[model samples]
Target: MLVSHQQNSILKHESLLVKFLTKYLSRVDSDIYFAKSSRCVTHSFTKTATVLSMANDGTLDALPVVGLAHNDDKKIPRKRVYAWAFWDWATQPFNTVLITFVWVPSFLTSTFFLDPDVVGTAGEEVALGQLAANLGAGITIAGLLIAFLAPVLGQQADRTQRQKLQLMIFTGLLVLTQLGLSFVQPGQEWFWVGVGLIAIGSVFNEIAGVNYNALLVSVSNSKTVGKVSGLGWGFGYLGGIIALATVVGLILSGVLQGDSALTFQLVALGCTIWTVFFVIPIFVSVPEPKTRQVGEKLGLWGSYVELGRSVKRLYKEARPTFWFLLASAVYRDGLSAVFVFGAVIAGIVFGFGFTDLVIFGIALNVVAGISTIIAGRLDDRFGPKNVILVAVFGLVACTTAVFVLVDLGTPMFWAVGLILAAFVGPAQAASRSFLARVTPAGREGEVFGLYATTGRAAGWMASLLWAVFIQLAGNQAIYGLLGIALVLLVGGVMLLFVKAPARSPR
Candidate 1:
């Protein structure tokens, strides 16, 4: 009797094992599974084991799991979305205040004393040539350094989970550097100080931007990326406008009364404050992305080897990305040149004053903000590439009109300038969206770093070319601007040939 009972017990155990295995396998083979505890049904093979174990009170959960995989949701929540967008708002004050409006123009006018309009002499020519050389040399060195190091740093950040920390360090550097601009007194020495700060700040900005961009994947789903990106840009434009407005108010009010040099010094302080305060949101709200461990230890040489391999892979797998980069590099460089010289041309050539320049800047920002917001809808409708083409054409036309109607004074000036500003927002917003379309998953940071690098790579060249044309032509800033128009036209034509990738999500 005892032997018979033992045999029955063994049979019962075998029966339960067989039942569990069969049920698990069947669940894996089907598309749907029923979980009794959660009282919900999931339609995926990968979740079968979890459903089955839950249905059976978790006893069979330890069975060797097979065919398990994870599915990613391509959507983002609304709150985090806004927080992510605000990062751009925080950083753009640096671009507007230090680089564009106050510091650069002041450096050219005050430190160098290069008259915006040099009449009937080689004086203008020599000054422009020297300015071009200095700008070119600075950007070239910065671009080369970024190209070599950005990707490696991105890779290391991915491996080490240090992206947020890197962002903090770089952001702090940018803020400190801008604040340091306060001490740049009116002298030739100030020129060097200005250039050095610009160069270093630019480097840190690019580095931080790369890390910040990499975090996009973690912040939002693929569907919301475009909208999220547009929001960031919109916020950036708004920030720039606010900062510019404040500076203009202070200067115009005579509250900061002093020489032009002292007025500019106050403007620099405003920019520094903007940089420091705006960065607080990013530091507080944005979280670092989770990083996976690198399988093998890499020495410095190994890192270089890996980077070289990545470059090779980039060329092979991302041919479209390369072409886009090439086109973007040329056109973006031209755009930089246009803005860099816009205020100077208006003041010196068109006889615009501080009030006029401030108003123009305000108009540019307002138009650009509206255009960027509209571009999001257009991007979803006709695709980012189509919007980019339209923007590029608009850029070309406006640039040409600027030169053609050079004699129109303020009316035609504001007309053409506003039109150009309209394109600026869409072009920039669409360019970023187009890049987002082509960039591979998991590499947005390194790729955006390249984007920033490419934009800056030939920046000096464009400025140099413009300066040379103006210098050689003598009192023909219009002719120099025409050269810029040609670049935009050519870039637009080239972009037409390249096919844009299929649109996905927002």
Candidate 2:
């Protein structure tokens, strides 16, 4: 008896089909329920049914705007939609500039920070290795905090309907932390300062991501979520490319003044500015979602209890998604390590010079951007499960190639390393698509927060294994590839046990 959305006649029919499906979806008392298309989720009979979501053609007819106040604003406007997508475009520099391509391994691991007191006693190699290990430790500790807090924060945002507000606050904190990097000059005195700032910036970045991801449901539906997610992810990689290009340009034009430390500091400042100016459109264009009708907001302690119940609820009612989170968490961390340690591997194992590495990084980002966008389309057509399987399999093969062919020189790296890079974004984007498909409608924020938490839960595994492999091989770093590949392979194998969500048609 659900009314059809007037936007598309085809969707009107689809809505009715979804209404019929809803009868089954609402039977939570059953052992489990499966819905087609991740975006078509509905919550109880009282919540909005995203029935007219995905279609056979992959493009969706616009549904009612999530929080539009005006009756005439029935369709999702193009301007607003594009503005919403720009958030990924704006924040790409954090990943590309600070994390992946430019900052951490290249500068923080440099000899400039070696303590005068320990330079001789500790040995330069030992000192540098400790810096790298210390950085990873900081992130691990941060991950634990995130694992504990993200769900709680997300639960609060869902009830209050302030997902965007949460995003902006953390984003602002991230910018401030990025700005603090300017104070971290050379020598032991300032090394921990740099590490602390990056760790804190990472926290702000991740916590903000919880709200940013939840916003996906507000701006998109089943039909377009895959491509939109792709677009955001693609833009993010492209943003990193652009940020790195700026660094290249600065170096070429002599704007960086030949001080490597100064260059990194300037790059961090530029990334901060990029995030601030670009994140404005979402606030200006996308309104906060209407508050949920799902009872009173729980207190923080109660939210944890509710989260436990929610997990139990999901286990009984959405078993595939519950297990999928556990599986995806492990692989996603491995995917992250591919980038996190890639530059290090290239520098230490394959002997890539700074310029060689930077150029290669730019090329890698370009590949990731293109691959993620294409895979988004694939995600829409073949289902996210299929896309993820292919990407992860490709990752395992390509990563193994990097390990097996370590003796072949930079040419080997150029070939298989780029292949390794190509699969990473697709796996990441598809996993997000996979989760969105099964998540109940009203709880997008909290569930996506769980998505972030679970992903962090196994955050230590790949990094720990990398250390283990390196030590086992008598510190021959090439053996570290096996560590990362093992995690991805195990995680991918787990994905096989997770059944794909049923697909709905328009």
The number of the candidate with the highest TM-score is 2
Cα deviation at 232, candidate 1, in Å, is 1.2
Structural similarity to truth (TM-score) of each candidate: 0.76, 0.84
Alpha carbon deviation, residue 317, candidate 1 (Å): 2.1
How many backbone clashes can be found in candidate 1? 0
lDDT of candidates 1 onward, in order? 0.63, 0.73
Highest lDDT among the candidates is held by which one? Answer: 2
Q: How far in Å is the alpha carbon of 212 misplaced in model 2?
A: 0.6
Mark the regions of model 2 whose C-alpha exceeds 4 Å error after superposition.
1-41, 45-74, 117-122
Report how far residue 194 has shifted in candidate 1, in Å. Answer: 3.2
Q: For model 2, what is the alpha-carbon lDDT of residue 213?
A: 80
* Model 2 worst lDDT run, 10 consecutive residues: 64-73
lDDT per residue for candidate 2 within 1-506, as digits (tens), equals 00123125323433553354335224421211111232323453223223433335534321212221111123444445556666877777776777766677667767768877666673777888888889878877778888888998888888877788998899889889988885678877888888888888888888988888877765555555566577678767776776677677677777674357777777777777777767888889877654354546788899999999888877765667689889999899899888877777999988888788889999998899878877876786778889898888898898888888888988988999788778988888888777766676567678888899999888889989999999999998888889999999999999998877544342
